[model samples]
Structures are given as C-alpha cells and as structure tokens.
Target chain A: MEHTQEEIRKHVKIYISVFAALAALTVITVAVSYLDLPLAGAIALALIIATVKASLVAAFFMHLISEKQIIFWILLLTFAFFLVLLFIPAMTS
Target chain B: MSDMIRYISKPHPVTGVTNAKLGIWCFLASEVMLFGALFSAYILLRTGATEWPVGADLLNVPLATVNTLILIASSVTIVMSWASLAMKDLSRFRIYMGLTILLACAFLVVKGFEYGAKFEHHHFPNSSTFYAIYYTLTGLHGLHIVGGIVVNLYLLFPGSAMWQTEPERFLGRIECAGLYWHFVDLVWIFLFPVLYLL
Candidate 1:
C-alpha cells in the first residue's frame, strides 16, 4: 500500500507487457485453429495457449503473483482437485 | 483464541473480508470440474456416435464466431475494471464494469438468436446424439454468462457502500467475479470449435 512512485511505475510496465502478450496469444489461437494438425496436436496446442493466457491473467491482471503464499497454495490445491475430477472417470471407462 | 485473533488482525491487501476472494476462487474451481465433466462426456459420446454431425454442418460458424469474440472481449473489460479499481479510478472502474456487463448481455442476445435459429431448423438436441450433447454443453455455458451479468450489475450500483468504504476489498470481489468469467470464456473457447468450426 505504501509503494513508491517508481515501484508503481515498474509494476505498470510489467502489466502492460503481459496484456500485450495475451492479445498476441489470442491472435495465435485463431490462426492455429486453421491449420490441419492432428486432433491430439490441435487439442494440445489449444490447451497450451490457454494455459499461457490464463497465467498472464492470473499473474499480472489479477495480481496473484504478488499475493501472499497462502493464496498460492489455495490456488494450487484447487487446480489439483480439478485434475482429479477430469481424470478419475477415465479409469472406470 | 490468540491464533484466531492474530489471523483477524492481518487484513489482506486486496480485501479485509479475510477469505472472501479465496473462497470465491475455490468455488469457481469446482465449477470448472462441473463443466469439465460435461465437456469430457461430449468428447466420448461424439467419438462413439455413428453419424456425428460435423460441427460446420450443424452450426452457423459465422454467428458463433461473433459470439466468441464478444465473450473474449468481455473477459478483457472485466479485468480492466478491476485494474481501474486498483488504480483508485472509481469512475473509470464503474465504466469498465458497465461495459463488461453490456458485453455480457450482448453475448446472451447472440446466444438467444443462435438457439432460436437452431430450433427453427429443427436442430433440437434430441435430433441426434451429437446435437443432444452439443446443446447441453453450450447451454450450460450460456447460463453462466447470464449469471456473470447478474453479478456485475450487483457490483455496478453506486449505493453499494462496501465499494466506497473499502475500495480494495470491493475490487477483490470484482477480481473473483473476473476469474469466474474467464473460466466461462475458456469453456466457450473450447466449445466453439468442438460444436461449430471443427
């Protein structure tokens, strides 16, 4: 809360860069969808791009990168739970 | 007693509501799983069907393409709204949030049109095994967009003293809302191709 002006400016610069990267990633997603990649390749590419975009939103736009460590663990555990749900059913089938 | 007191004494930088944002985030994670199950089911069913309707034949790709862009744009505006709040620009924050809500409404309108068109063409989910799952998957995502609009409108009002007295905390709530929104957008991103373009 008591950040100096210089510190604030530095954060702003980084945030802008992240937003720009996300925009570029959006363009890439649309472009890649046009290619004739295998189904698995396409799905993998889409997911990878999505992960990069989400990380930018979470880290810079949402400010999670600067947040407390407890919050990080909460986020990580949540994702872990999500993986369990996604894959657990595959075993039975 | 002392540990609880100490925990209460340490306010989060973004919110004083202790675990409010964290709680919201955790809830949204569960939502991801809920949608994930439906999507995975879609993959399995479509794979097994004898005459799977190729997405292009079953969907109006141009219209869905517009809807996709609208959702992705809303994701950007919602994040910008939170950033404006963090920068202490209340007016700008309100404007951004309003735009996000409008964009969300636009998405719903387009979705309604798409559904209407589908019904006109006798494209009900029951029409085929694929349409059944397609409608169910995208329909769930559509409901989420409507939910997001309601949440944003609730936060947009000037009479909400919580936003006035604790700006950072209010912003954190918006951030939590944004997370839910981005997840919804991501689901559509996956669904668009699976149901329309592909």
Candidate 2:
C-alpha cells in the first residue's frame, strides 16, 4: 500500500514522536536498572519496557500496524514456532 | 516472458507487497528463530548455573546504555530516510540515510571500546558462562549493525542509481533496509537489558 506524500509527511511526525518515546524509555530502563532490584524483579521490569519498545519499533518503523494480512500470518506462524523453541528449553529445565 | 519476475517494482495484487518486501519478512522470521533459540539457551544455562553473575556488576551498563540510544536514533533516522523517499525528496533521503549510517558506525565504535576494555581486563568469552553468552549475543548483534551499515551505504551511494530508472522500486528497497535496520535495533533493545541490566 503506497502512502501519498501527505500521509508520508504525517508519518514523519509520528516517526519523530516514536523516536522520542524510545529515547526516553531507554533512559528510564537504565535508571531502573541502577535501582538494583532483585534479579527476578529487575528481569521482569526490564523485559516489560523492552517489549514495549520493541512493539513501538515494530508497529511504527516496520509498519506492522498498517501491514497486510499475509505478513501478519507469516509473523504469527514464526512466533508460534519461536514459542515452541523457547518452550523446549523451559520444559526441559 | 515466463522468466520475468512480475512484482519487482509493484505489489502483488493479492499479497499487497512487492516480492522484496515479502522476502525480507521471511528472512526476518528466520532471524527471529535464530536469535530466539540463542535466548532460550541463555535462559536455560543461567537457570541451571548455581550462581549467575549480576549483569550490571559484571558488564558495562553505561556504555551499553549509550549504544542502545544510538541504535534507537538510527532506527528513527532509517524510517525517516524511507519517508523522505516516499515523498520524492532524494536529497532529504540522502541526509537521513547518511545519518542512519553514521549512527550505526558510532554504535560500533562504542562497541569496540567496550570489547577492548573487556579484553584488557581479561574478560574473554571463555571467561565463564555469563561471559560466553554475553559475547555471543552482543557479538552477533554487532555483526547485524555492521550489516545494516553496509546496506545503508549501498543505498546512499552506488545502489542509488535505481532511483532514476525505477523510483518506486528503489523506495521499496529503502523500506526493506529500514525494516531490517529496525529489527536490529529491536534485538538490541532486548539484548541491553538481558546482557547489561539483568
């Protein structure tokens, strides 16, 4: 799906906003790390922030939010297989 | 001709994207699995170890933090470059793409110093399980940055001639490169916390 110049101009604004959010999130994550929480808590908080950051990148920069159905299915299948891979190690341990 | 690829410059009517776009997503899917497996290995090994080293204490958090921000900036710049092309501004595209490449190189320079410091203090990959996983993950991520730099450089200079012949197709290439670059940044987002914070 091709965006018009107007839509792209609008996207440039969103891109800048996402960049600011990502930069702030990066700093927040680092500060949270220095709090020296317990390992499990640190892991949980850090992962949550990282997931949000990843989502922003995927949705905006990668255009997954407006992406086509075929790409969605492809990613879903990949995620399913990826979960199975992670589960193997978890189940074994 | 039967040999001609129909969707090089246009989206397939059904699939809704050019072949290059779909192909890159498939490639990224495989990459996700590759990194996912390594992350799983990291989880298992750390869980099994009687004592896993605290990440910040053992690794360099401040430097990793800077690198993380640098990569995030590059991700934004890359998307901006793509946007510039979409709007038919080749010179603006060049500037944004050039910034993306420069930020990528800056990330590597920071990584180099981090690694050099590690080696100076005798923190080789074989130093322990933590160091091993640390090197493996970050090293692979670094290589991805290098790959992004190479692709962005091509798009910035020699490969840019395609814009004259087929601007839309060339823009598609930029979109693909931007996607790949963002994925690399996404990987680092997780890696920083996993290797440096946790």
Candidate 3:
C-alpha cells in the first residue's frame, strides 16, 4: 500500500521512539537480573520484560497492529500450539 | 492466469494482504513452534538436572549485551529503510539498508569472538548441557541473522532495480524482509535474558 509522506514521517518517529524504549528496557532487564530474586521470580520477570519488548517490536516494527485478520488468526493458532509445546514438560513432570 | 497475477500483485479480497505476505506469516508461525520446542527442551533439561550452572557465570554477559544492542539497532535500521522507501526516497533507503547490513555483520562478528573464546576455553557444545544449549540456541540465531543479511544485501544491491520497475511490490518485499528481521531481533530479546542473564 502506498503511504503518504506524512504517514512515512510518523512511522519514522515511532521507530525511533521504539528503539529508545527497547534500549532502556534492555538496561532494566540486565539490572534486574542481578537482584538475586527467587529463580522462578527472576525468570518470570525477565520473560515479562522481554515480552513487552517483543510486543513493541511486533506491533510497531512488524506492523502487526494494523495487520489483516488472517495473519492474526495464523498467529493465534501458532500461540495455541506453542503453549501446548511448553506444557509438554509439565504434563510429563 | 489473471488470478495468479493478482495474487502476487494485489491484496487478497479476504486478507487485504498479498499472498507473499500471508505465506511469510505462515512460515513465521512454524518458526515460532520450532523455537518454542527448543526452549521447552531447555526448560526440561534445566529442571530435571541435579545441578544447573547459572547462565551469567558461564556466558560472556558484556559481549552478549553489546550484540543485543547491535541487533536491536539493526531492527530499527531495517524498519527505517522501509520507511525511506515508503517516502519514495531510494537514496535514503540505500543508506539505511546499508547500515542494517553492517550492523548485522557487527553482531555476527561479536558472536564469532564469543564462540572463539568458548572454544579456546574448551567449552565446546558437548562440554556441558548448558554449553550445548547455549551453542545450539545462539548458533541457530546467528544463522537466522545471516539469512536476513543475505536477503537485505540482495535487496540493497542487485534486487534494487525492482524499485524502478515495480516500486510497490519492491516496497512490499522490503516490508516482508523487515518483518523477518524484526522477528529475529525479537527472538534475541528473549534469548538474551534467558541465556545470558537468567
């Protein structure tokens, strides 16, 4: 799809802001890792921060926020299967 | 025949996206499962083991942090390249795309040094379960970065002529590449904290 110059400029600004946010979050993740929290708590917190960062990249950089429904469905299915994959360990344990 | 051409050249009626776009998303979906399975295996091995080494104690945290930044920067540059093209500025597109490739190379180089250090210290993949997982995860990720660089390089070089002939399709191709690159960066975002910090 053709983008107007204004839209392109807006996207560039968003990209810059997202980059800055990601960098800040990276620092936070590193600092928090050194806090000596319980292992599970640390892993959960780290994954939570990483998820937020991943969401920013996916939503803004990948343009998934405005993506078509078919792609969303595809992702939804993927997420379902991915959860199943993760749960395999729990099932056996 | 016309349907095939339309499938490639125009957006689908149902999806409002091109076939290539849809195909890439599906491919990426499978990739998510692939990596997910590996990560699940990592969890199983870690929990089941009698003793597990802390990640930070074994891996080069400082170098990995730098590589993370480089990958993140590359993600921005790739998106910026697409934005430049969206503005119909081919020159700026080239500059941004060039920077993206350079940053990709920089990440791989740092990764190479990290691997070299591991080998020098006799920390091969078979050294320990942690090392095995470390090498497997990062090596696969490095290969993905290389794959992205190869595509970006083609677009920045010989494949760029499409911009003059079919600017819209060319832009779409770059957008797809940017999506893949961003996904690569996203994987590393998780990998960094999981493998290096946690």
lDDT of each: 0.72, 0.92, 0.91
Tell me the number of clashing residue pairs for each predicted model: 0, 0, 0
Q: Which portions of model 1 miss their true places by more than 4 Å?
A: A1-24, B1-17
Q: Between which residue pairs do clashes occur in model 2?
A: none
What's each prediction's TM-score?
Answer: 0.81, 0.97, 0.98
Put down candidate 2 lDDT per residue, B1-198, tens digits, no spaces: 723877977889989888889999999999999999999999899889999887888778888889998999999889988888888899999999999999999999999999999999999999999999999998998898888899899999999999999898899999999999999999999999988888
**In model 3, which runs have C-alpha deviations exceeding 4 angstroms?**
B1-5
Relative to the real complex, the DockQ score for model 3 comes to 0.87
Tell me chain A's TM-score in each of the predictions. Answer: 0.88, 0.95, 0.97
TM-score of chain B of each: 0.88, 0.97, 0.97
Error of 2 at A79 (Å): 0.8
| Fnat measured on candidate 1 | 0.12
* TM-score for candidate 3, residues paired by index: 0.98
lDDT of 1 by residue, B13-40 (tens): 5654356655776776678778877866
Clashes of 1: 0
Clashing pairs in 3: none
Candidate scoring better on TM-score of 1 and 2: 2
